[model samples]
Each structure stands twice: as structure tokens, then as C-alpha cells.
Target chain A: MKDFPGTPGTLTGLMLRVGQFTFAAASIAFVATGVRFQEFTAFCYLIASMGLQVLWSLWLACLDAYAMLAPRDLRNPRLVSLFVVGDWVTATLSLAAACSSAGILVLYDRDLGNCKESVCQRYQFAIAMAFMSWVLIDISSLIMFWLLAAG
Target chain B: MKDFPGTPGTLTGLMLRVGQFTFAAASIAFVATGVRFQEFTAFCYLIASMGLQVLWSLWLACLDAYAMLAPRDLRNPRLVSLFVVGDWVTATLSLAAACSSAGILVLYDRDLGNCKESVCQRYQFAIAMAFMSWVLIDISSLIMFWLLAAG
Candidate 1:
């Protein structure tokens, strides 16, 4: 199997994990800090999903850092399989949360005309951050899937 | 590699594909028939995503049917990789569409109180069907991923 840049236990993989964690945390912070976010179920779902992403990415980032520092291999088939499953699950949840929140934002901002401009902006920013996190997770999930295939 | 029930060219796989197609079509039918669905971008997105699912599932179902009747091998590594990628992409899109639509439905039905009872019911039904389609796609995507891993 050819080595991929974002393969688990590598510096690149650690960067990707950290990126996911940062974006997810930012997303949560943006939404949670705003007024009335808790009133919307979609926003709450986004917070929950991003919270899960934060934990998953933080855990993996730590693992990747440890593996690099300890000079350990992280390509065991069982471990890779676990990574693949976890990434897929998180990627799916993250995408769903982001998309759902975006849908609600669009409704509130455009069609419904219920949201204040400032609140809408904040929600949009949070959704965008969630999407950024999802993109990183999606990439890492694809990498993990390919690694499992090659293994 | 152990044989899985939903591998791309098998009878069970064909059934799964058919189920996905049927549910996606049902979702579209329910939403499209309802009045004012086009007014909501989330509903439109759902229609578009389910349309893609319908086409993809129908194409693959035909392929699965042909492969089974002809007794052709469909377990090539490259072919499985293609299946994995396709399934993952469609699964993600399907789930996003379903979830986003559901979020909007919740907003309309619960928070905003703008939706009429009958319309809300129809929309709810359509979203449920979309979720059904997503579930089947998720299952097949997982099977394909595992197939790639076992390959």
C-alpha cells in the first residue's frame, strides 16, 4: 500500500485532526455565545454534533502526536478499521448537523424574515465553521477508507 | 474476507438498491405533489438529492441484476473502490438532504406555527421517506467500506 500524506500516526494526519477540532470548537463557540441559539433545535443539534467532533478529533490528534513522538506504527488493520468506522460516523453526523443548521438559517434569514440580521450573521458564521470542520473530517474519512482498502 | 450480505453484485445488494430507489422516489413524489414545496429551498434540495439517489440506485440496481443473471464477478478491487466512493458520496448527500429538510419541517411545524396541519403532515411523510432512503444508503455504504477493507 502506498503511503498517503494524511495516513494515521503521521504529522499531516495530526494537522488534519487539529484542524477538525479547532473548526468544530469555533462552530460551537459561535453558536453557543449567541442569543436564542438554544431556542432552535437545529442549532442545538449542531452544537451536540460539533461537540462530538471536538472530542473525536482531539482524541485522535493526541494519538497521532503520541505515535509520532514514540516512533510507533499505527497501521494495524483492526485499529484502522476502527478509525474508518469512527470517521464515517462522525463525518455523517457533522455533515447532517451543518446542513440542517444551514437549512434553518436560510429559512430564518430569507423566507421567514424572522431573524434579526445580526443573529442571522452569527448563525451563518457558525454554520460555515461547522462546514469547515465537516470538510476536514470528510477528507480524513476518505483517507482512512483508502488506507483500509489498501491494507 | 467474509462474504457480506450487501456486496455490490449480490441479490441482497440488489434488494437494498431497489429499496433505496423506491424510498427516494416516494420522498420526491410526496414532496413534489404538495403545494408550496418549491417555496422552501430545503424542500427543493431534498428533491434534488433524492433525484440523484433515484438515478444512482436505479443504475446500480440494474447493474446488480445484470451481474447476478450473467454470473459475472463484481469483486474487483478497483470496482469495489468505485462502489465505496459512490456509496459514501450518495449516502452523505442523502443524509444531509433528509436532515436539512427535517430541520426545516420542525421549524415550520413547531416553532414558527406558520404551517397548516395538513401540509405539515405531508412534509413530515416526505421527510420520513427520505430518511428511509438514507438509512438504506448508509447500510450499503458501510457494507461497501467493509468490502474494500476486506479486499
Candidate 2:
């Protein structure tokens, strides 16, 4: 299989993982700082999901950094398979969390006319960060999938 | 790769597709019959997502049936790639839709204490069906991904 920019062990891959970690962390930060985010199940779920993403991405980023420093191959079939599964699972959870949080925010802001509250903007920022995290993970998953397929 | 039960061109694959279609259709039916699902953007998003799932699954089901009747091969690499992409896209959308709808339902029923309304029950049923549909599609997508990797 032809090597791609974001293939495992590459600098691009490390950057992708860092990006995912940053966004997920930001998501959790926003939600945690917001008032009464725990009151809504969706926000809580978002926090949990983003927390997982942060951990997963941080772990992978470390691996990627080590691979870059060691200049070792990271395309072993089993390793790639593991990456694919992990990426897909995290991607799904992140997307679901973001969507659910966004749904609740929209319901409150538009339907119930509650956007005037400062917390709504915080929720929106958190959800947007979650979404950005999801997008990065989705890309990573797709690339891992393609790599596995080509292998 | 060893052949699996739910591999494309197999009876299990057909059954999975049919299951997805049935659940998605039922979700839409429940939501459509309920009062003012359009009032909330989340419910409308659920309807739209499930409607897409219904069409996608129905079309795939028909193809599966035809393959079974003809005993035709359905494991072409390109075709499997297409299936992987389609299944992944639909699965993500279905899950997001289900989660978002469920979030709204939870907010209204538990947090807001609105479960006494009959419409709440209908929405719950619809969200349940959506979740069921997502489960089937998730299975299908995973299988497709495995098949693509093995191809």
C-alpha cells in the first residue's frame, strides 16, 4: 500500500492525534466551567466522551512521538487493526456525545428561548469543540481503515 | 480471510439489512404519528436520519435478496469498499440521531418532568427504535470494515 500523509508513525499522524487531544480537552474544560452542566445528562455524557477521547489521543500521540524519534515501523497489521478499532469506537462516541449535546442546546436555545443565559454559549463552545474532536478522530479512523484495507 | 456469517452476499447479511430497514421504518412511523415532532429540531433530525436509514437499508436489502436468489458474488474489492463507506456513514448518522433524540427525551421526561404527556411515550418509542436501528447498522458497518480489511 502506498504511504499516506497521516499513516501511523508519521509526523502528520502525530499532529492529528495532538489536534484530537487538544479539542477534546478544550471541550471538557468548557463544559466543566459552565454552570450546572451536570444537570443535563447530555452534557455529562459529552464530558465523559471527551474525557475518553483526550486519554486515547494522548496515548496515541505518545506512541506516535516515540515512533518518530525511534524511526520505527508502525504499520504492523495487528497494530493497525488495533488502531482501527480504537479510532472507530472513539469516533462513534465522540460524535454521539457532540450530537446529543448540540440537540439539547438547540432545544433550549430555540424551542425554549433560553439562549440569553450565559451558560448556553458555554455549552455551544463545548459542543463545537467536541465536534472538532470527532472530525479529527473520524479522519484518523478512515485513514486507518484504508491502510488496513490496502494491507 | 475466512468467510463470516454476516459477510456480504450471505444470508446473515441479508437478515441484518432487513433488520435495519424494519427498525428505521418503525422509528419514523412512531415519530411521524406523534404530535408535532417537527417542533423540536432534534426529533426532526431523527426523522430525517431514520428516513435515510430506511432508504439505504431497503435498497441494500433488495440487493442482498437479489444476490441470494441469483447466487451471485458480492465480494468485489471495490464493492466492499463502497459498502464500508456507506455503512460507516449511515451508522454514524444513525447513532448521532439516536443519541440526540434520546438526549432530548431524557431532558423532557426526567429533568423537566414531562413524561406524563402521551407524546413523551411516543417519542421514547421512536428513540428506542432508532437505537435498535443504529445497533444493527453498527454491526453491519463493523462487518463491512472487517471484510474490507480482509479483502
Q: Per-residue alpha-carbon lDDT of model 1 for B4-98, expressed as tens digits?
A: 79987899999999999999999999999999888888899999999999999999999999999998878887988898888888988888889
lDDT of 2 by residue, A50-113 (tens): 9999999999999999998998899988999899999989998899899989889989899878
lDDT of each residue in A1-151, candidate 1, tens digit only: 4577999899999999999999999999999999988878889999999999999999999999999999888988789889988998999899989998999988777777799888888889999999999999999998888788766
Q: Which fraction of the native contacts appears in each prediction? A: 0.64, 0.77
Candidate 2 chain B superposition, TM-score: 0.96
Error of 1 at A22 (Å): 0.9
TM-score of each model, paired residue for residue = 0.90, 0.90
Give residue A6's error in model 2 in angstroms: 2.3
Candidate 2 Cα deviation (angstroms), residue B53: 0.9
Lowest summed lDDT across 10 adjacent residues in model 1 chain A is found at A142-151
Listed in order, the DockQ scores are 0.56, 0.61
Pairs of residues clashing in candidate 2: none
Residue A118 lDDT, candidate 2, scale 0-100: 79
Candidate 2 off by > 4 Å: A1-3, B1-3
Model 1 regions more than 4 Å off:
A1-3, A113-115, B1-3, B77-81, B113-115, B148-150
